[model samples]
Target: MSQPELSEDELLQRAGRGDARAFDQLYDRLAPRLFGLLRQMLYDEKEAEEVLQEGFVQLWERAPSFDPERSKAFTWAVMLFRHKAIDRMRMLGRRNRLVDGAVLEQTTLGGSSQAADEALQDAERGEAVRQALNELPKEQRQLIECAFLKGLTHHVIAESFGMPLGTVKTNIRRGLLRLRDLLKGGA
Candidate 1:
């Protein structure tokens, strides 16, 4: 006799790309098996609930990266859910490693934009630059703000702010120096 075949991965992939029906199919395919496995592994109902739900959420979030070549869909979810539950077991040591590895991977993939919408979604890259304005001192930021936002003449700003034009110039230069450091630190 032959076992029936299932398109578990195709459904999960569609779900990962935001199809509601695919998500439902994935839930139908995996939820019962997961609940059973968790029941055998965990004694406390609350612990099982937390671990199972967390595992499910990670499945949804990271589903886009799941590769059928690596493992069967059911086995992958089971392994992930088990590791998630077990992580709560003794996390102090291994938690840091897991977080660090994830951070490293995200760093490498940070610049990948699948669409123009995704790239423009930040739309506030300017505000991000403004926040990084920590690169400049208050005086410099004020000067740049006055010069750029108000369209004030540099000489006029120097006179209104009670400073010589050259000092204003000096602050703008040094402030830009600090901002470079701030943005680098963020990355």
Candidate 2:
């Protein structure tokens, strides 16, 4: 007799109990959609693939904690993958910023006089932004970092930080307004 196709919840339950085949089945069923989502978010095939792999690893480890009452298995999986993609994007952004800063520093220190002048202006703008960020309260700064630097949605930030969704949204709005005022005032 042929085996019946398992529902996602069934597969999840089996996988949660350490059934490798069930986990593989779940991957086979969900990988394409998850990959597509990650690709759209990350805009790089290699990074999407990496995030997908990491997501699966996380799913395997956290499967036992999956709460059907809270969300469907597929939804949970997607959330995990999305979070992983965002994290990878943030890491890449930070790395690129660091590399760019180093190159800018080198050019400023050794390049022609005109290029050095441009780099100095860039440095001053960067310093001003840094000072503005420092002036924010810690919570507001964190909200701004999550929204802008990490490219996370307010809902994701709220969920990850265990804050109310409205609170997250309000903080981001207020933070941006404050940052705008600070920049306008040349603080």
Candidate 3:
């Protein structure tokens, strides 16, 4: 019989242990979805492509620290890429002010108006995610808030909050699973 397909969580765990094949598999599964998200967030194809590349490099560097017990591989990756894309947006915003008038004119002339439609959809989805997060039990919601909203890692959260590492990881895992379910049902 053929080997069973490994879950993304399992693959990520293996990748953390230096399994190149597992890393490749994880990349194949996640890149398209992540790229699409970057496109929506950035609304610039070249910037999205650059952020995607940079995000993957960061992922590989950070893989060894990943704990499947805390969060699913895809969600962890999405957070990483989202942060990268946000940083790119901030940098672009700063640079746009320094550009010549010709550059501004060129961008407005070439830019897609579809970004407005995507922004509306993104806002709706963000509201749904916020509602779902609010529905979580207090402990889970707080832990998730620390992790995602504050951008703290499990270790840092544990240290900062005086909780055991395992407790922090468990709460995050449960909260993320619940949040995923809530988003899917509401979406």
Candidate 4:
């Protein structure tokens, strides 16, 4: 026997009444785009599929509580999918070395691979900074090491390095400016 199709409202009504076929139809309608949504926030394909399945399962479990008059069925499901995507991203973020935590969170929009590539580029730029630090000349580097690495005040660094405070400050500032220009491909 062939299954009869229903309008979205009827599907939601039946789904809310515990109709398994209606739930399956709802999952079929939502799953493909939901996978993409999860995948954008999480670059892992397997994890994205799992989260997509779990979102559908929760929709089944909670469908009875959903009020269609307040929101479209698709709208409700998409919001749940987006929430799960962010939840997964947050779990992944806690494990990674996030440089700009706010930017990382804002950019992981559950949307595109282009954004992911930009985030990777930013991380690469930070790695370049570390490499640049290692290549600094000794005295110039020592000023930075004491001021930033050891968290010492500039005056303390000047006293420790046995230099006029102004000279010590200029060495650190000019060294950093040179490093910035080098990283920008200008030096």
Candidate 5:
């Protein structure tokens, strides 16, 4: 007679007790499906693979804490992979934004200026906006730069700068209002 296959819960229970073989079996059964899910979320093959490895490592460490009352073992594992993939995506997005911002800043700095009257008018408006931005407090200016110029969300900016989300939002709002007032006065 053929040996019966162990169910996921059985495998998880065994693995939780520090059975390496059971854990290996669990990894073999779930890795492909979890990796596929991660790949779909991340949209990059290499990154998906890396996140898969990371997820499994985390699972190995956390297997002892699995609770059947809260979620199935499979669901818990999938959540780990999903969270890892989302974090990777956010990190990549932040990096891309920074690189794009740098490139744009370089392009603007090196741009050739036309001698036309319209070009002069546009330059003057740009200068006014820069002057207004410079007039704001340093903290407000930094928040505005991260939220507006770099296209970061308030939550992301808060995490990056280690500030509270409410504080970041407040600073951005105040900075924009101050900038608007300065522009109106200058005009």
Candidate 6:
């Protein structure tokens, strides 16, 4: 009889133990699905491809810490990829913000009073967002700040705060939902 194929969890476990063949098999099995996910998250083929490659490198380094009792290999891999994608998004956002600030400064210098008025409006909107975030419960607010403003991954936030992963995710989600509602109502 032919031998059965190894399960993803089993393959991951073997990879954790430094089995090169098992790692290759795991990559073959998971890369396509992960690439699809990255494409959807990044909305740019090149960025997705880069993240997929980086995420696999990270996965290899971290796999020895994978705990099957805590979660499946695929779920663990998904989290790693998602974190990488989010980091990429955050980096892009920061770059865009810097470019926008420069543009705003140049416009204010060259344009009429209308540009100044727009900048003032932007400041007011920022204050409103700050106030809205302040209205959240402390736990939710802290988690949100850590994840977004600090650009920390969910796993890092959970570990640093000594909270369960589920709790961290839940708080961030609920906080964002409440912040959205507050913004909409304010607007």
Per-candidate alpha-carbon RMSD to the true structure? 21.2, 12.8, 19.1, 18.6, 13.5, 14.4
Off by over 4 Å in 1: 1-6, 91-187
- Tens-place lDDT per residue, model 6, 103-130, is 5665677667666677777656665566
TM-score: model 2 vs. ground truth = 0.60
| Clashing residue pairs, backbone N/CA/C < 3 A, model 3 | none
lDDT of 4: 0.74
What is the per-residue lDDT of model 4 for residues 125-179, given as tens digits with 9 covering 90 to 100? 6567655654676577667767765678988987887899999989999989888
Please name the candidate that would achieve the greatest TM-score relative to the true structure.
2
lDDT preference between candidates 3 and 4, better one:
3
Model 5 vs. true fold: TM: 0.58
| Candidates sorted by lDDT, best first | 6, 2, 3, 5, 4, 1
Predicted candidate 2 versus true structure: per-residue lDDT over 1-187, tens digit per residue: 9989998888988999999999999999999999999999998786787788889999999999988889999999988888898898887677457545755766667756756567777667666666677577768977887887677998899999999999999988998889888978844
What TM-score fits each model?
0.44, 0.60, 0.53, 0.48, 0.58, 0.59
lDDT of 1 by residue, 41-151 (tens): 766455576677788889888788879899878878888899987776654234334434444454446666445554444434444455565235557877866775457
Local accuracy of candidate 5 as per-residue lDDT tens digits, 4-61? 9998877887888899999999999999999899889987777788789888888888
- Enumerate residue pairs that collide in model 5: none
Give the higher-lDDT candidate: 3 or 6.
Answer: 6
Candidate with better TM-score, 1 vs 4: 4
Better of 3 and 6 by TM-score: 6
Cα distance off (Å), candidate 2, residue 7: 0.7
Tell me how candidate 2 scores on lDDT: 0.83
As for TM-score, the candidate ahead, 2 or 4, is 2
Name the lDDT of candidate 3.
0.81
lDDT value, residue 86 of candidate 1: 77
Among these predicted structures, which one has the highest lDDT?
6
Local distance difference test scores for all models? 0.70, 0.83, 0.81, 0.74, 0.81, 0.85
